[model samples]
Target: MNKVSLLSSSVRQQSLQAVALLVFLVMGLSGAMGPTLIPAIRVVFGLGLSSAMTVQWIPLVVSGLSSLILAQLLHRFGAKAMVLGGLGLMTVGCLQVRLAILAPFGLDARYGLMLLALAVIALGTSVIQVAANLLVVQLGHARTASARLTLAQSFNSLGVLVGVSLGTTFALGAKTTTAPTMALGIGQAFGWSGAINAAVLAAAAMVAAGAWGVSRTSQAGQAPIRAALGSGWALAGAGGIALYVGAEGSIGSILIPFLHQKSVLNLTLEQAGHYLGWFYWGGALAGRLAGTWLLHRGAPAKWLGMAALGAVIASALAALGSGPVAGYAALTIGLFNAIMFPVIFSITVERSAAPSAAVSGLLSTAIAGGAILSALVGWTGEHFGFAVCFLVPMLAYGLIALFAGFGALLPSVDKAPQDSRMTSSVGNLSERT
Candidate 1:
């Protein structure tokens, strides 16, 4: 190719990579919005705490199951198609939820509709998670894949922060009315639902625009799904991912409530929630930004091990200490969690015998741990206390530490030979400089 052509090609590739980051940002926004919307759902439907929790967990379980099945279809459809389809599903799901909230239907009927909408959203998210992770790996060089994934995830954190803030502002700010005919005004209840739907639609439009920019590459020659599933290293990596997500989710889900305890931070619920964002999610964004640089300089496994250790220590301090010390220790866990997903994901993809799609699918399935571990922590908190519940994540972090420390010794699929076609293309692109 000529110099100008080469530069254009390079720009195209970079643009496609930016699309993946945008996808991650959308995923983060939807993920955060789900849990944050629970209280609003409860108010609109007059649901008890346990019933509200059931509504929250349903989507997680669906997402996990969908990921396993979606993995099988990746080779047939390709990443571009899957990503676009996933975004479409999210757009539809959000619209359904929004319409359901605005409908004149009874609360019970609307609740059922909401569940169905969330399930659709979950399925879409699962597909996007699988496709985006694999696509990011393909978009970058193997040596810097971890760094690239982490950097992209930093945008994910930014999305989460924005989603949480918006959800809280629009949904939680809804005012109750004294009107006899309506306990809660329609306008108030639908505010967040409308906002969420609009956001999802906007994201879908972005994904559609970017979809036209990337080539429709196929994975027909990659390793089969069966072989990837059988790989021991892939399984180990999946376990580590599960545990890490479980630990991170459990801690984050409880942070606000834990800090609200009289003996702990003794803050109001809103105050505790605000601090949760700053110390937990905000710390995650900072850590990911820093971790991108750290991963570029050292082995990902070593960094993973160190991060796991930090989580263990932080959880222990949160569990055993009291007052501000406990609160700070609890929030500090987010810092360590920042890189685990990307590092474990990159390591699994690099080492797995399966194609990137199969590995990504399996890894995405492990995210169900968030639902499982969060429930466990909730039970522990009810029976014992929030301090005691910290042990659940602490144990999870301990296992992750072991995995990152020694699990590499296990056998894995040899790295795929570099494709000459891709190399030549990249080389030609670089010549423009």
Candidate 2:
């Protein structure tokens, strides 16, 4: 078949869409569990706020470096093998965390081990996210890729919601912040998640055995990594995506505590977190649903600009408003942020066809922006208070908004159909398992 016909054939399968959606939800469960583990880790390990946040960065650091290597891995192993490998790593990492936490040890020693375990888990998650996202876009519709990402990510938010709630409940009922308590509680949690993930990974592996090359075209054969990295637009889009993720992560990490401290609502940490989840994840879910459709009618840049404007305005108002009103306004920004990451990623992916693999890796690395931006916000919150800390994300959104409005231009690919924007920098492949 011709390249166009081949790619079209790949996109016409409803089963592919079902698998993408299913895997995304499972991935979401794992991803969402990550943030909730943060607070529990802090309480059990007695780590400071900055230190606790650093744990979150481990995934980004590992993922960033790993993403750089994915192009090579894809070339060597193919997308199916690489994805299963990532999933296997994730399962192993989770099991290790569970074992480490359950180990009998001194507080300091246990804390060190916990951090190490978290690092391992982060590495696995990074690979999974990068693989899953690329696969979804590759196997699904092009114009609707961003929307599908948004919809899938909404499940990720739901996973977070469930994890935090469960984590907090288990944490609260646990013993002192001693090593043993941490070990027992966290270990159990990891154990459960690990077992579940292992089952999923095993199933994915079985499916992949039958699914390799299910969607690949002759034109989709390997491209040089250097060529993919050279696309200026892809790199720029990656930067924007990085900044956007950082802003969102920072906000989500700190906003609940900020609201509790400054607002007249006078809620507890758990209460604040729950409300934050509703505002953040709930809005995220809604926005993604809406954004999926919006991308078809308007330019991504325009929609991004609008989302950014909403974030800035809502955040600014939340900063100014007192009592419950201010808190709600601040929470409203989650709605705006809901679609930011997927949209930025989709735009970047759409703009360049020369380096699909490299571009995916580069864009995945942009997640590091979360670590840097969140730290900045935490610092600002310490010195200036929660309201002013938001200024950091506001600036981030503003720049991204500008990019959406004028700085970015989506190029039209001439020959390739499935993803004319494919780049050797990153390969967009579907996960059949």
lDDT per residue for candidate 1 within 10-127, as digits (tens), equals 6656656666777787777666655655556666788654465555567767877888778766656656677778876776776666666667888899888878877887888888
TM per prediction: 0.86, 0.85
Model 2, range 1-433, lDDT digits (tens) per residue?
5888556545434434444455555555555444555556676677667776765566666667767676556555555666677767767877777766666777678667766766666666666666667766665456666776777677666656555555545542354645456446667766766776787677666555444432334324454556567877777777787778777777777665666674546775557667766777668777877877887777666788889999988777766777877678788888998778887877777677655666677888777666788787767776777778778888888888877864345563432443343222123433222
How much lDDT does candidate 1 score?
A: 0.70
> Which 10 residues in a row give candidate 1 its minimum summed lDDT?
419-428
What are the C-alpha RMSDs, in order, of all predicted structures? 4.0, 4.6
**lDDT score, candidate 1, position 202:** 64
Candidate that would win on lDDT = 1
Backbone clashes in model 1, listed as residue pairs = none
Clashes of 2: 21
lDDT of 2 at 204: 68
The Cα RMSD of model 2 versus the native structure comes to: 4.6
- Alpha carbon lDDT at 16, candidate 1: 61
Model 2: residue 372 alpha-carbon error in angstroms: 1.2
